[model samples]
Target: MRIKTTRQQHILRIKTTLRWLLYYLLIFLSFIIMTSGTLYKPILLVPLAIAISINNNIYGSAVTGAFCGFLIDICCGKLFGYNAVILAFFCILTNLVFELYLKNRFINYLMITAVVSYIQCWLDYKFYYQIWDYENVGRIFVRVSLRVWAYTVISAFFMYLLVKLVNKLLMPKEHLTIEEAINTNIQNENKR
Candidate 1:
């Protein structure tokens, strides 16, 4: 009886995990589709962050971060991993500070997008396009950096709206907050 019960619990857990994963994958797909078109000029990063942050997976955030980063690099036709590295780091940091009153407000995320956009744009300008030219470095920095930053911030708002909408279509089950889950386990063990 004990062994059967344990096996059943394991199966149930696996099913729950798989279901959660499938939902996130669909949300990620929809996000890509919405951003790919002419409606938005590649402000996908901010929206990606908003989307990832809504879910319960810490690992998912990083995975989606790299995915979106790679997507941006590919769509914009730039060297690979330029946005991936930065985005992965941002997601990791966001995961770490989830408990620290970090509001999910748009402007807060927009600031993050703007800052990362600045760094990404600068790196692309300095390293990829103007590495040897050296003459137009100043102009490139001013124009490209500002353009990307503005675009990213603007895009962040749209992404927030989309995330809000997507949540209704596919909300994941509440898999307890980290602290709550641990506490519940402890309580159950004490009872046992």
Candidate 2:
């Protein structure tokens, strides 16, 4: 009985690890696809990271957000850790908001995504273009920043669905039999 319990625990750990790895892989794949030299890159990482934050704990969401932001920095050729910090902060805040105030619904997530994406875009425009006093800053903001924000918000719908599907597929099913439940209870009592 002890050996069987240990084996089951090991298997559960492996499954949990695999699920996290799949999430990271999804982020990497999105990074590659979004940065592949299209006329209008959609800033796909923003929505995807937000979607991830919606489903994960605060620490996990922050780490995922930092990873996504690191990719964004690389894609944009900006200073390292800039987007990472911003994204991590936003991810934590989003997680807290969901935990406290908002329900985890599609429209709610989309609205949050829009706000976060717009803030990112506006900050990028302000620091990189406006502060630098670049010629035609308004034009650049309208053409690039606004478009990127719109595209990112549009992509949020798909990212949210993808995240929901992944979560459903990987989440552990809790259908223990009576005997299994008894064994689990015994194990817990033994630990105490």
What does candidate 2's lDDT look like per residue over 26-97, in tens digits? 898898987798758788888889988986789999999999999999998878989999999999999999
Candidate No. with top TM-score: 2
RMSD of each: 6.2, 5.0
TM-score of 2: 0.84
- Candidate 1's C-alpha runs over 4 A off are 1-40, 173-192
Q: How many backbone clashes does candidate 2 have?
A: 0
TM-score of each: 0.65, 0.84
Off by over 4 Å in 2: 1-8, 173-192
Q: TM-score for candidate 1, please give it.
A: 0.65
Write one digit per residue (lDDT tens) for candidate 1, span 1-192: 122345555665776566456546754664566456663355565455645654446787788778777776666776798777777777767655653656666566666666766676677777876878876678766666666567766766766676655554555333444566678779999999
